[model samples]
Target: MTTFLTGWGRTAPTPAVLTRPRSVEELCELIGAAPGRGVVARGLGRSYGDAAQNAGGLVLDCTGLDGWTFDEGSGLVTASGGVSLHELMTALVPRGWFVPVSPGTRHVTVGGAVAADVHGKNHHRDSSFGAHVRSLTLVTADGTARTLRPGDPLFQATVGGMGLTGVIAEATFGCVPIETSLMRVDVERTADLDETLATMAATDDRYRYTVAWIDLLAQGRRMGRSVLTRGDHAARTDEKEPPAFAPGALVRAPAWAPGGLLNGLSVRAFNEVWYRKAPRRRTIVQGIAPFFHPLDFVDGWNRMYGSRGFVQYQFVVPFGAEETLRGIVGALSAHGTVSFLTVLKRFGPGSGGLLSFPMPGWTLALDIPVGQRGLAGLLRGFDRRVAEAGGRVYLAKDSRLHADMMAAMYPELERWRQIREQADPAGLFRSDLARRLRL
Candidate 1:
């Protein structure tokens, strides 16, 4: 059957033949019979853009391969591509273990995480999901299953390859041991962008996880006002009860919303309240759900942007490019971009994946509702500026980036393409993103 699919941002819905492969054998069989447009794996569909949408092609829904094992003594977990972080955390937290890294949302599959090399607040300390991967099994176009480990060329190509290298069948990765599911958090509000950067750079090393919520709509003296939240897992003594990992969305957005629901005026109001509500400074203990995955508390929150959808732009600049970061923020504020969710974080280092997004620097992500005036031109300018600053945008969250900027942002693109070609000479793996960016 032809199924229509879109990324979490709800943009560019495309049609494809979606299939669920129950095992490695089934996956290989499906790949062998892929249509002319080729095949790409789809997990929980949390990627904000077209990285997983294979228009008019075969879309393998790998969730059927959900199975995992944990070697508690070694803190290693061997999980099939379909297993979600939510599932893993629910099971592991009670047993005193947790995924080495987690993005803003836990609804992503193990394969999806590896494919995007997803990073989290702890990136300043632990790098990305790819860094934790011990090994991964990839089913090539020729039905050859190869288990590649770190330091292998093929492994680097597959990690952060955006599901274009091949379908991630299964993987084994190291997990972190946790004494409890709660987090000990500290909150601080920064008066401006410079203060925010200084505070984080000076003290981020003290915490395992840190992030800042910036009010992109602020201007002049108040431009870049932000709330910084940093935390680490709480010890058993911090919580009276045993660790528990049950989490669920507190509410769901309406299926239908007005296109202009998140306009400049409304988002500005929301940003003001959000900024003011965060205490100037405070220390508290929070449940895992609120600390790391607060957005997960609302199901289908993407719909809040309304039917026209939204665009997520994420980019990272090297440590010395603070001026570039400030200029971009100032531009967005001056333009009244109406981005309700703007986040800033410090990344320690890249995971060494050929196309991994992070580098030892600062990263910022913004969620802007589509159809804003001059949105395309403004973002395109940002692309040029980012590339010029030796920074790269996150492919997993991108939608509007042009192909010409790919080489400028990622110098290793050619090497990654070569390895991808060698693994699947017939080019049996493809996606709409691959077509758009010519990856």
Candidate 2:
């Protein structure tokens, strides 16, 4: 059927021939005889941009392939590409097992996680999602199914290859062992950017997961005030048992909202109230959902940005590139970019997924409505600065990045291209992101 698809950000909606195949064999047949527009695979479509979108092409909706098997002894789970992390956790957590990593939301599918090489708050301690992946079952351009391990060049290519390597069929990954479903969390309100960074640097190792919610609208004396939260799984005790499963959506957004619902004035007010509500210093136990995936609680919350949609700009710079980070933050504040969901994280190391987005350094993500005035030119300028500073933008969250800056941001893009070409010389796997970035 012809369908209009967009990423979680709701930007760059495009029409495509969408089909769902029940098994790997059916998918292979579809790819083998795909139309001239080419074929690409899609999961839950959590990527904020066109990574999962293919314009006027065959987009394989892989969710129909969802299946899973778990081994309690080894804490390893083998699941189909279409199975979401939410599904895995829903079943595993109650059985005393948890996904090794959890991103901002659990709505992402296993295939999507491997393709994007997602990272979570625990990134400072654990590596990316690819690091825990044991193997992958892939259907490549030649319509052949192959099992790949970590050491293979194609394996690295497929991990963060953004689904360009092939359509993932199933994957095996190790899960973490958790005694309880609650997180012992510590929160601190920072006065400014310096304190926030300093505090994170000084005490980040004490916790397994950490992140800071920044107030970008604040300028001058308070340019990066933040609410820093860090936590680790609680040990079993005589205390009451925490909720074994994450909570589902509580309320859905209205059918429609005004385009200016998240303008500078509204965003500033929200940020002010959010920042003030957080305590100066507090330590408490919280549910897993509230601690890790708070946004999931509000159904279709992206619509709050309104019909114009939103742009999620995520970039990372090396540890020594503090000046560049400060400059970007200052520019955003100066422009009064309307972003209430701004986040800052410290990444530990790259997982060597040729096109993967994280490394040992600092990364910041912002959600700005598409209709913001001069937002394009402003972001383009930031792109140049990021490339010059030896930084890279996250492809999973990118939409407007130009082809010229891709190689600069990701030094291994050429290597990734070589591997992807070898895997699919006929260019069977394609997406709007690949076309836009000339990948």
Candidate 3:
């Protein structure tokens, strides 16, 4: 009845009474009678931190509620909250439709995606997952179900509410039309930070999807050197190259891999090899899987960080705050913080979820092995700088942010909190993250 649960990052593992709700009725019953620590929903457990974990409380695992419907004429998709994006794509792609927006991985549940309001490479063009959603069903603490639509205050809160408002039962969202699953990709390597920023700024509007793999270990003249990949769904209508189905992990890491395996030297070497491997300028046709979800190929790749787990630090600074972005990247290089994978992208505009992370700005994400000396202090310093620049960290990937910083990062926090309290006045919807950051 009790199990130890941790986020994808494997940090702050906690024990909870985990329940799998096979139906909306069952979920409502469980929530109405949740234990003292309160109730929260868990999807595939893909969140990097404690957003879905309810220590010493009840956790409703929503995977069993899988159900979906599609309308060919309008490209509208209605999927159960527990249904994975991979499952959705598996069905949609063959029908010549694709998710308008997707995070790096397809393993995320539709509910999880809505709750996080995830952004992808297309963010510079399409905004976030919440923007495409038409309506959603919410099962609140009081055992009632409500169908909320866009432009509703409660709907805005639930979009990125992290499940505090209640359990997301289902979502109806618009899908994009695609000729094929293949992408016509253009790759170019930038010489330095300024070049990388300028290039993306100038040309990003030309592509539907774009992202940069930045070399965080590089310093001096080579600082922020990166390989930029920009692409759009290929117009190739060849039936021979049908869209791909959901892909499985190409390989899985051992559970017992040693920790601290990504030290500075190893990371530097990896970055060096990765940078050199990219062509200076090239064009290629790639599958949507490889181009969007490369990390999905290596199952349990998180294990590579060793038993101690790793921290996924992602933050965004508004446009014109380029100075703040430069300072943070420079600081990381100086600290020799070993980040094996780093990404940089420009966001067009936010979906306006009260607590959504993306805005019209430059966002960067890094994977850092935890337990490094002064890692906490280093990240906190970065947080202060981001806050001062009118920026915020991504809640879905956060583990150590201070509660005091949330208001500054999100100007609409108090308004969102008011809606949340009105929905679940007794605070029946709760999680470790809620407690940690006082959300």
TM-score, one value per model: 0.99, 0.98, 0.99
Q: For model 1, which pairs clash?
A: none
lDDT of 1 by residue, 213-320 (tens): 999999999999999999999998899788899999999989898999988899889988998999999999999989989889988899999988999999999989
* Model 2: per-residue Cα lDDT at residue 29: 96
lDDT of 3 by residue, 1-439 (tens): 8999999999989999998999999998998899889999999989999999999999999999999999999999999999999998888897889998989999999999999999999998999999999999999989998999999999999988888899999999999999887889999999889999999999999999999999998999999999999999898653357666667899988877887788988888988898899999999988889999999999988889988899999999999999999999999988888888899999988897999999999999999998888899999999999999999999999988999999999999999999999998999999999999998
- What is the lDDT ranking, best to worst? 1, 3, 2
Candidate 2, residue 202: Cα displacement in angstroms equals 0.8
Per-residue CA lDDT of model 2 for 165-198, tens digit only, reads 9999999999999888888999999999989999
The top-ranked prediction according to TM-score is 1
Tell me how candidate 1 scores on lDDT: 0.94
| Each candidate: RMSD | 0.7, 1.0, 1.0
Q: Which candidate should be chosen as best, given lDDT against the real structure? A: 1
Judged by whole-model lDDT over C-alpha atoms, candidate 2 comes out at: 0.91
Q: How many steric clashes between backbone atoms does each model show?
A: 0, 0, 0
Candidate closer to the true structure by lDDT (higher is better), 2 or 3: 3
Name model 3 segments beyond 4 Å from true: 237-240
